[model samples]
Target: MLKRVEKAQQKWGGSHTVIDNWLNERQELIVLYCKIAGFSPYEKKDQSLPEPSQIQAFCQILMDYLSAGHFEVYDDIAKACEKKGLESQQLANTIYPRISDTTDIALDFNDKYAEVDAEDLLVGFDNDLSVMGEALEARFALEDELIDNLYSNHAD
Candidate 1:
């Protein structure tokens, strides 16, 4: 029993670290988003749409975040659940489709606007940004649910 608990800790400890890093990345993304969207310190009066390069940078980060979740984090959670002999299929079924839907929206947003020059962004870009923001907000909530349902249970 001690060995089993130690192994579970070993498995979950690494995932907990990864989840912490991912959460930090999410915070950074949120700040960058607010900067580009002209909230708080980047007030509307002094704000302009971020440069094309900036958007590209954010898109790269966004892609990294998404990739890490799918390729690393989710796999780790599934493995941990399997190790514990817990049934996570229902959780996966509920969350995976929502996450996939969000991924499609994010990719579409990145493709459409990541390359647009600052000048082009001045014309009707707000609408697209608004949609992206909403999608991201929903996505983040869904992701938090996943963590709570899956990772929190395994936390040492």
Candidate 2:
């Protein structure tokens, strides 16, 4: 995820302020995700689920990131495509429903685990996390493609 975000930044950073800020948010979100998932190298090798408070905090950041992508980033891209009369609209129309489905899964994951204590989460938590992680990976790939299209068509 970090690698994909870095590639996106390298390709599209500085082309527009919105894209730069969105990429920065993506970096922050990934860091939070890594920390929660115990994927941070700086953290210990304990692959246990984080505490309830940590999960709740992560959920907050996740919601914010999701909201920004839907409300600000996607809206801006659609407006830009409309302004430029680009066929990106068709791409967006194809991708948006799938992205929304992924968003639903993410939000469901957040709601399910946000308030779960570490002890309770130990039961079947790994499977839930695995599903959420896969959904997120797919979501990120779709989002990156959307960003690439937006940048290629509209960035100056």
Candidate 3:
């Protein structure tokens, strides 16, 4: 996941302030995810789920990242595509539904994690995180394609 994020940064870095900041936020979310999922290089010695505060913090960042992508980034890109004419608009229309699928997966994760007690999460947390990781990976790929397709001809 971290590797995917790095690859994205390299591909899209310095493209625009909006994209750069979005990528940075993505990296932050990935680091927090790795730490919580016990896959980080600096993984804590303990095996149990992290403290509620830690998970809550991750959830907060997750929600913010999701919100920004949907509200700000996608809106701006869609409008740009509209202006760029039908080819861009068609590509965006095709991609947006797929992206929204990933968004729903992420929102489900956020809803489950952000609302529950730590003790309540113990039964399915690992599975949930695994699914979240996979969804995020798919999301990153789709988002990269969106940026490439929409912004490659010209940076905004």
* Predicted model with the maximum lDDT: 3
TM-scores, one per candidate: 0.79, 0.87, 0.88
- Where in model 1 is the C-alpha error above 4 Å? 1-15, 84-87, 119-122, 154-156
Structure candidate 3, residue pairs in collision: none
Q: Which residue segments of model 3 deviate by more than 4 Å?
A: 44-46, 154-156
Clashing pairs in 2: none
Against the reference, the lDDT scores of all candidates come to 0.70, 0.80, 0.83
Residue 4, candidate 3: C-alpha displacement in angstroms? 2.6
Local error of candidate 3 at residue 50 (angstroms): 2.0
The candidate, 1 or 2, that scores higher on TM-score is: 2
Clash count per candidate? 0, 0, 0
User: Which 10 successive residues of model 1 have the least lDDT summed?
Assistant: 1-10
**Pairs with steric clashes in candidate 1:** none
- Expressed as tens digits, the lDDT of each residue in 2-120 for candidate 2 is 99989989998887787788788878877777777778573656555677777777777778889988988899887876766547788888899999998998899888877777567
Better of 2 and 3 by TM-score: 3
